[model samples]
Target chain A: MARREVSVLFFLALLCKAIAIRSQPSTIDASFCLSWRLAVETNNELPWRTVPNKCSQYVEDYLIHGQYERDLELIMEQALDYVNGISIVGDGKDAWILDVDDTCISNIYYYKSKNYGCDPYDPAAFRAWAMRGWCTAVPPILKLFNKLIDNEFKVILLTGRDKEILGQVTIDNLHNQGFIGYERLIMRTNIYKGQSAVTYKSNIRKNLEDEGYRIWGNVGDQWSDLQGYSFGNRTFKLPNPMYFVP
Target chain B: MARREVSVLFFLALLCKAIAIRSQPSTIDASFCLSWRLAVETNNELPWRTVPNKCSQYVEDYLIHGQYERDLELIMEQALDYVNGISIVGDGKDAWILDVDDTCISNIYYYKSKNYGCDPYDPAAFRAWAMRGWCTAVPPILKLFNKLIDNEFKVILLTGRDKEILGQVTIDNLHNQGFIGYERLIMRTNIYKGQSAVTYKSNIRKNLEDEGYRIWGNVGDQWSDLQGYSFGNRTFKLPNPMYFVP
Candidate 1:
């Protein structure tokens, strides 16, 4: 009986060692993943197709945990503070620009199936998912949208989603998700087909200014959305570590 | 004896409860502080004075631990990769701009005493520290500097440090830290006394361009160092959550 007990203790020790060995790489990966996400968000690391395979679990945990929401909440608070300070011209030309996907509504559900963007982007799969219009409002951003409307700012919904395909469903999805009363829902037309997001968005913004719209604020999850000419007076970036548009 | 044992157990449970209660706020603060740091790093949260009091320990741990070094390593890796891809003109006009403080040399030793920037900025104290010239080379950045020098790229040290007060000491600090063979060390002069960092750096970059220097890469810890006119072909930001420059 004593021999059996000693063997059991030895087995337990081996098991602990195995568990430690298994966890050690992940522990290192987790720290590197955090740095990678920061680099992505800061636009230092750009033109990436997807999250690193090693960071799949890290990104999943970051999104599943309350940290993602908390980050958005802080951004929302700051945006509201900025808006409160704005003296709206009341000329019906005071505008605020918000990116659609991952800004107005979350693609978390879709990304969950895609390993939180660890898998390479499948455009057709994403289009099918968008056509389904299953995205829900990012709660704090929905609040920001409503606040913008209440403040009488012309909230333009600027997105890179193709107008020929996803436009109608996007409108329905946004309206269903409490993003009503927005001034315009602008999507990519065939004319802007091959242009990069920065070029496309910049030209659109230039047009808005040309039409006498005073863009007060811009909010986006992707840096491409906030960059380029006429990028408004203040730009707020929401966190989206899952993928990069440009 | 049983009564005494029961009393001791009750006391132990109360002690555990007290410890849990004491740790609860810090746990919450830790999560929020992480989000805060991410926001700051991404340039979403801006125009801040110092590190939040709640984030003091968080920032301290991030610096003291190996995470800060790992982050810098990743940035250095990316910067080197970018530098490798550049086609140098070989006309002695290829240049890279690097910010001095917190970029080429680290001020962690100084920030350590200042509660990792939880304390408010005391310009007099910071200037005194600068005058002492005790900063060390950020190892990865030093490597990048040497690489640029080896590649015959002119390394320009552009800093917001006052030229009249700390210029010589800054040069000595850089040299002692092995940051040798740089093209120029540009510091703030009295003429730019009241200008913001963005304006000051932009004007200098403009002057450099006017002088026939092709700015290929810019590296700095603060966004102000990378923003504004003539921001180079690429800009890399190193992590510094301790303080804000603009």
Candidate 2:
């Protein structure tokens, strides 16, 4: 009897291990895929102000106590300097480029814990999660974006997030947190359902540069945000402490 | 014989009368409708290069005489300046934010004569057209982009195009024009699909700025292009005298 009980326990443990391996979370991948889909399908309808499970604590620890706050502040200050730093000179005309995700909002825990990247998804459950829409910005970074809006400079939120989920979710999330209104929101999407995030984001940035908006500053957690077909400028990187890159 | 001749003459006069009220050629309606259909359905994929008609003449004449050389030079110059306008002085690093469309490639004629807006799309046609790989950039503009590449400024291209189509067409188009490499292609998907173009673009720009890219310059044509989430220092507007708001 004792041997049989041990054998049963061992079998269950082995099965659990297999499932865990298969379900390792990829917060960046899942969040990224969701955001891209939202951008193309939902048109940036993300509920902007849902307090993400990991948001408040992450802000207090990594952002407030971590180096990110100072890093972001320094970045913002330099960005605001215009000619001296980002070449943002004078009035409300100067434009600043900011990234969503890890830069402005917190989504890591939701993506990681839920194992959202493992595919085999339930659309209804995903929508349910999105409906919660309670996320906090990366401490000083959130405050900084508000500063840009208050200072009269154009504040634009460019992200790999999907446009489809941004409407009520994004507006509510941001407005609830006191994030000011933005002039525009550029979301990444899947034009053909199987495109790379790299190509989509890069091409769009090129087109934006071609349009003549003076990009005084750019902020993001990854390198993709700062690089465009014709424009490369001063960028601030907040230690994602989470994850990014291939 | 006189009666027969009179009948024939009368018939001919009646045919002429039936067509007299028309202001232009009989094919004008078919053509206008066709162009409008192409514009609306095909995402501006009308092959002007393949249409060996007066439209070709118009294109040739415009390029050869309508300040083509001068405007090209100015656009190129402005593009370079806009890319160079950003810098990071106070911090450890800086970045640039670039807008795509008229700033990177030449797509105005396609959009203008064809007549297209962000909305009012034909899904199947737009999807196919979006997949086309020969979407080339304006010659002089390419030259300027290439110059920026040579100067070693990190290049990023932000645009309103979807990310799904980024792989083949956007890359091939920019690459065929000559570029050492590009860092990012920030794109906008269907996010903010119903919002004003200004609001949409601004959101994307702000996201980049928050990421810490000291945007130097943003070069584009439309006012929305020049004024997005991130306002660059120098905005270069190329001449797009043909199109208007949708």
Candidate 3:
């Protein structure tokens, strides 16, 4: 019995040795992960409070390694494949919905200058940056958009920015940043004031579908952009750990 | 001057109203969202820190509305539909991987008694719960598992539980709770001690694929379960706002 147990233990040890997982730091530790998450939530929701100072270094490290950009590229690659595989079911009705901020253009420079959540979000400063029309295109998503356009898919730009106040600047920024020829640019209206993003985007998409547009792909960095009815055939979410919309 | 500025003033008023995106709790003002978030990260990563008391009511409210259950059901329903649609390419090597805890059996009863992160995690008490073999199955996931089995896809169980310490108990618990006839049940060994869930699960899944098993679908509550390569053709994530696992 002792000999048999030794053999079994030996075999098990071999199996365990063969299975070496966790070699890479694919997932961050608990404290680090939580800190990162809190940074995002505070940035998007509670912009008044500053993120903990200790977490700033970790956030910088994450961004420095280009983690967010890498994830976006991989996810958008899948998006490309998915869109490429689909057959457009109708004419001028095959539309792809794209969220504006963070989805197509990045505000990383602005966030970085603010110490990556260590500083409170300043709406006036953000508006100033928006008006400058200098934010760079999120390369991966921009590439995906170009492919969709190349494939004859109607591209619609949707955003939460004030259409009346920032509308012209927003358009100029997209055009300046290499995004062009979108089917339509839909911005928040007085009707959607104070409403949740899910409610606002859902209503708009439903209206577009009602107008004979078939949303083939919907991509966004926020859950509000993807969830709810009238969500396209497939929804691709790009990472934005820096903020949560709601 | 007043008459000349009338047009600009009217336009500005229209713009302000139109741009009112973040007005109605643009973010949930309650500290609950942050607290709830911290709780999940702590449970999965640190497991030592006590989640704040202020967020307990919010967590309770989320649980009371059956939000977690509802989300799981919806996600699993999607998984079921996705798995059903796939055309099996291999003889019998196609598999559906599942995480055991929270994904299959739920420890909600034990958690509710602990005030949902108000108290520090007690492993001894948790082990006692594990030994009882009474934790209920996450209903929707259980249903998904049954369908996968019925569909003849190889159903494999992977979990972060220690194989040496709780292997038999885990097996019995799964079997007792209506989960039966899985192709394999993999648990963490001494070799993977103190590793992140993402690293551990990723290596294991990669190994399974290396052994020629084609993973068709993966369902889990944590990002760690779904992020790595050799991931299933499709990944269905269940909602678990209560606790995160790596």
Candidate 4:
């Protein structure tokens, strides 16, 4: 009887270990996160893995336990300090570029089910999720944006989503989530279709500059959102190993 | 004794089955191939997988058995048919844009070592591989490029490789691989740094058009190489499931 009990316990232990491996975040923590950020900066993409992929247990814990929120608070505090340092030269011409997904809104719920980078991106499913328009505001960024608006800085929203398909819905989604009163909401048109996010966003900033707007700050979760020509005076990035947009 | 013998045979069979599963090609059949081609046409990325990945067993077999070459021959034949139907104008200003990697040269041997997309891209290793300058010609496209030149279509070579680092080496590599006599070889410059492949390439084509060159044909393995404003009259694409560039 004791031997049988032992066998049962062993089997249960093995099953628990398997579940733990699958459920744990795979890419979080200081060293791996640093390497990952560097790789992303250098234009290197990570391959999807069935086992121990990029998203880590710490990231899940961080999100669920409010550590992610704390990090954002700290980042926004720094951004505010920088904004305070700069003086506006033009009337309402000092603009700040903001990326939509994961910057202003949280996709944590969608990514929680997708196993981060383990599963391939399903566009139809992603579009369905987006259309639901239920994503909540990322509190820190929302606060910063509101602060910027109150301080008379022009806030411009940019995203890689198609203007023809997702434009109206995205606007509604943002407005419903408490993101309102922006200078312009730029979505990729057919002319800029197939452009890398960097190129599309960079060109838009250049156009804004040409129109005599002074870009003062830029912020996004992806480095692609920040790196490029005409990149404003300062840039802020949030952590996101859930998915990479090239 | 009989029970022990039976257990041993079952174990051996199970081991054999496991080996077969690991070695089998997953995604290289006709239907998947067609779907993959379509996905690549509309979007430019495919995440890596360990099991039944995008690269099919049929593709491996095709590459090894020279079926890939035969398929290329068939595709080039169609391209030739299309080219014959079109009329060229503008003196020596009629141009054909040719992408260097994959469309003009095969990185088959390099990819084979990395299990296709199973491994993440290694730039240091890739640069070392490229510096050897030993990549062979993708014979069918080479033939088409040469044919276009012979037909008085000014062939233009374009690549995403950085000019500061790989310019001379790439030129020599192309020349050594029998890819000679092009009207221009444009490599990405520091001025275009941080630009997406689409933007960098599209701007180059637009510049050529501005200079009075009429683009008649474009060919590449990546959609980013073909899609954008100021595109040529026609475009041809080759198959590549190995890696993606944004």
Best by TM-score: 1
Q: How many Å off is the CA of A155 in candidate 2?
A: 32
In the range B46-70, model 4's lDDT, one tens digit per residue, is: 2223313554454465466554565
Model 1 stretches astray by more than 4 angstroms: A1-26, B1-26
Per residue, candidate 3 scores C-alpha lDDT tens digits across B1-246 of: 355455654564554444443222113323335333532422222232554576666567555655455545545655666777888865789898999888899887787887875777788988888878788888888898999888888999999988887899998889888999789999999998898988889899999999889998887877678765666776666555555565
| DockQ (Cα-based) for each candidate | 0.39, 0.01, 0.02, 0.02
lDDT of 3 at A138: 93
True contacts kept of each: 0.43, 0.00, 0.01, 0.00
For model 3, residues A6-56, the per-residue Cα lDDT tens digits are 575566545443332222222234234443443242221222255557667
Candidates in order have lDDT scores of 0.90, 0.51, 0.72, 0.72
Shift of residue A137 alpha carbon in model 2, Å: 55
Q: Which residues of candidate 2, in runs, are more than 4 Å off?
A: A1-246, B1-60, B63-66, B78-93, B108-127, B165-167
| Better structure of 2 and 4 per lDDT | 4
iRMSD, model 4, in Å: 17.5
Q: After superposition, how far is residue A101 of candidate 4 from its true place, in Å?
A: 34
Number of the top candidate by DockQ?
Answer: 1
Ranking by TM-score: 1, 3, 4, 2
Candidate 4 global CA lDDT score: 0.72
Quote model 3's TM-score for chain B: 0.79
TM-score of chain B of each: 0.90, 0.60, 0.79, 0.80
